[model samples]
Target chain A: MKKGKAHVLKIFDNVNTDYIISGRYKFKIANMKDLAKYIFEDIEPGFYKKISKGDYIVAGENFGCGSSREQAPWAIKEAGISAVIAKSFARIFFRNAFNIGLCVVSCDTSSIKNGDVIKLDLKDELVINISRGERIKTMPIPQLMRKFLDDGGVIGHFKKYGDFKI
Target chain B: MGKTIAEKILSSHAGTELKAGDIAICKVDFCFGQDGTSSLIIDSFKKSGRKKVFSPSKFCMVIDHSAPSPNVGVSEIHKKMRDFARSEKVGLYDIGEGVCHVVIPERGHVRPGSLILGADSHTCTYGALNALSTGVGSTDLAMTLISGKNWFRVPESVKITVNGILRKGVYSKDVALRIIGDLGANGCTYNSVEFYGPVIRRLSVEARLTISNMAVEMGAKFGVMEADAKVAAYLNENAKINKGIEGVTADKDAKYVKIKGYDISSLEPLVAKPHAVDNVAPAMDLSSIRIDEAFIGTCTNGRLEDLKIVSEILKNRKIHKRVRCIIAPASKRIFSEAVKRGYIKTFIDAGCVVVSPGCGPCVGTHEGILANGEVAISSANRNFKGRMGNPDSFIYLASPATVCASALEGKISDPRNHIRV
Candidate 1:
């Protein structure tokens, strides 16, 4: 996996899987590699070839909008991406990522830039600009939640927590 | 301290008695929209010139209806809606992320006890988690965007006591369709229906959702069952299922707005002929009209369990090659679950073409659009002509078993023939 300070290249507000992996590729998703080829096909058809694993995706407003299909996040997470930083998340995608243990953070990522070396601290709830020495006012994750994420999302968290206390 | 769930919820939130037909204003926990309606609703909100929305930013918008567009026009519409939502700083969900309801709950936005409102009629599905959620019209949606509150006619309660266990090859959809068939499309106009009985508790969340989501189809303001252990179990394992909003129940001696009972033990697969939800009858009685295509997905019945039931039935069988069977999940959660569980592989192996989630063939817009004179048996909510495309395509409504069996035989065969209770 490529490693570096997470530098976001773009922030698509409402990029959906139809754009990521269009229906045209439906018959072609025999594996992850094939699925990655079509991610954001509607937005910037060949953009995946330019993305790096350490690169961040800072989306505006409700970043991962649309159906509860895990394919959208599956394609995103499987594409070697480290994390998706968004302003907010749809109810389902947010939980799905948490459940699948995908690293997704919600913060004011609107101003974060392409190639900016940003450090996301899940514990302190900070997206620090290591290069610029700037700190973003990221929403703090509750201790219980931080613990949940640290354990690698809801499923793993559940595995650790065992039975849920409703 | 001595009240019911609905009353407790309304009192805690609205700080009032919350009687039937009385309107109350409370902060919304969640809101929903999609490509087709989101743009219009947002535009309407902008037109209202409202400064702040009534609810939190936890509102959602999904692009399910016109997803993977059948035409460039629909795509353009989705684009415009997305652009507007982005500009307004509202959530803009595009196609393939997941359907609104399924995605919302998965993401933790639809926690239990939270009140929800969606632009789509099936918004009532959120009630499955104990949220006092329901659907509203475009104008009302605009108002909610501005004020976060809508006037509601707290419907007089109607108790539908469903007794007797359903026979094998039958499901909650059949029970719901049976109720719809009995109550007609407009049977319980502006009333709340509470399902009660021994068998009602046995139904899964999917089944309950299947029942409550169709409340709109029958002109019900809302359909609920007493929040019980199953609900607690779901919330315990699933989303943040809280000691959710409680509500009023019919008095033991109090008169009901309406009361209906169904033995349902001997009910047959129903086919809502065409145009209207109440235009229904026994599926076996329906003419074995040759079908061009069949669909088994929609917000109404696109869940994994719905497909699982059908997959189990079709295990040793095959869909007639002459007829196409399209199955689309309602949300990505269900789709992915089906995949992880190998149900999708099972379905494909059985010759059924699985598609992405959303309102596909059920809306007649795209994905498995039927041609002229084609007949289809589906687990979807409606059977209006031109619904599955091709005005001449006759559509029959049935449970998954009926649809699967009919798909196997290339004729409308009752699911009962394949099993014994």
Candidate 2:
């Protein structure tokens, strides 16, 4: 659980992986740090340069739709985003983000304004809009998903357990 | 409670009767990764500090995306995948082999009632055979490669029944697009779709493959149909099915979260408009919209029947000089069969560019990339913005028949008036 300023990309519904990181950058690069520079490069040129560390992204429904590109979440995590709040997410993307230990919250983000400095307590499953004096409840992360995130991604989970045990 | 096909399969694999949303770790029969995602899987596998894979035979790396190396960077990625496969003693399907979804089933690697995973979204394509297949990210895939098992929250089942006979010129592609349109992109999110009906059972194996391939487009964990005579025949002829197919069907009393029915008796050709797959409309309604390119090949419609129809349409006619027709067979087997059947020769004579068996232009990796301001009528499942390359370019998803007619007319034309019965 943590509090942070929201730096919204304000994208529409069904924000696909291709938009997050173009296919051109998929196989051409190996290191996610290098690949992070191209995240959302097509949709908003220099998006990586603009987002700050620990910033949260509020988006519409079905965010991270399209392609099973792990780079999508890797880039988002590498971009220093602490959390992503969307109305819903594509199942694969939801799994990918959790496997990488990226915080993805599902809630109605209609009232969240860009740069609202919202505070999030994931353990309590709550989002607080400090500037707007608003408090929103978010869906609870699944029990198994929280375990994976707690261990800092699937790799870390495996290292700690000797196997991916829930 | 009687279990649906999804539940039945998952229960069998989990060694227990499971209901929807119950989290459990299930053993995987087989798993694969395409070149696009395999690189990441390798990185994760090494990072996991594991030496030997759980099972070498069950794991494989496919190199169909950006095959033959579109550039030096892509070629280097392929080299890395090849080296990893060698070191791990896992299977490798190199470039020119075919799309992973097409080749895996064509080679008989998939069996009814099995659980398969791939690091690509379209892994659900194997669900055509009543297998519980779904996509996962590379990190999950890497974990599976190391342990041969992964956790899953059993998804609720949605029963979609298609009845009635289809009219000529109305193909399975139209049926799939119609389903997506009816159930928006995320309508089936996190749910397994169980397709049943006389019409679906009657469809050829290739047609079943076409339908299941787009299951992900509807946000389904899997779009599956029972293994019928057609599926059994395909498996007996091409693949080794060690188990009887009788146990794969959904029980008569199977529970469904929802049931939707569609009659294809009066179904017409459908097209998914630009930027979204669910933005569908009748093909006839968009006839006036001209196209700059026509792609007649993809995992969705690159089978032998697709090539046969495309060649029939373009046999004695030249494509409109303004339209660039690009045709690629989904796999090497299909490519060779099309060539042997003279379909490839006809396609070439009609001014179409035939590439090797792989997913090229669909992912904007290689061959036939559309420039900005261009409009393309494609047979691929997705038509998202810039999915085929330039974001400024537009893509319309349609059947191979519609794509061919549009290629000849240089516009988004319907195939009803063109194809002869």
Which numbered prediction scores highest in lDDT against the true structure?
A: 2
What i-RMS does each candidate reach, in Å?
Answer: 16.4, 1.0
lDDT by residue (tens digit), candidate 2, B1-421: 7878888788878888898878888899999999899888998999999998999999998899898898888888899899998888999999999999988887877988889999999999888888889999999999999999998889999999999998888899999999999999988999999988988888898888999999999889999888877888888876766466654877788788889999989889999999899999999999899999899777799989899988888887899999999998999999999989999999999999999899868888779888889999999999887788777889999999999999989898889878866
Residue B306, candidate 1: Cα error in Å is: 1.0
The docking category that best describes candidate 1 is incorrect
True-vs-predicted CA distance for residue A73, candidate 2, Å? 0.3
All models, DockQ values?
0.01, 0.79
TM-score of chain A, all candidates = 0.78, 0.94
For the predicted complex of model 2, DockQ is 0.79
| Alpha-carbon lDDT of model 1 | 0.65
**How would you encode candidate 1's per-residue C-alpha lDDT over B283-316 as one tens digit per residue?**
7886456666777887777787887887777775
**Model 1 spans with C-alpha error above 4 angstroms:** A1-166, B1-12, B51-56, B111-114, B240-255, B419-421
- Model 2 spans > 4 angstroms off: B240-243
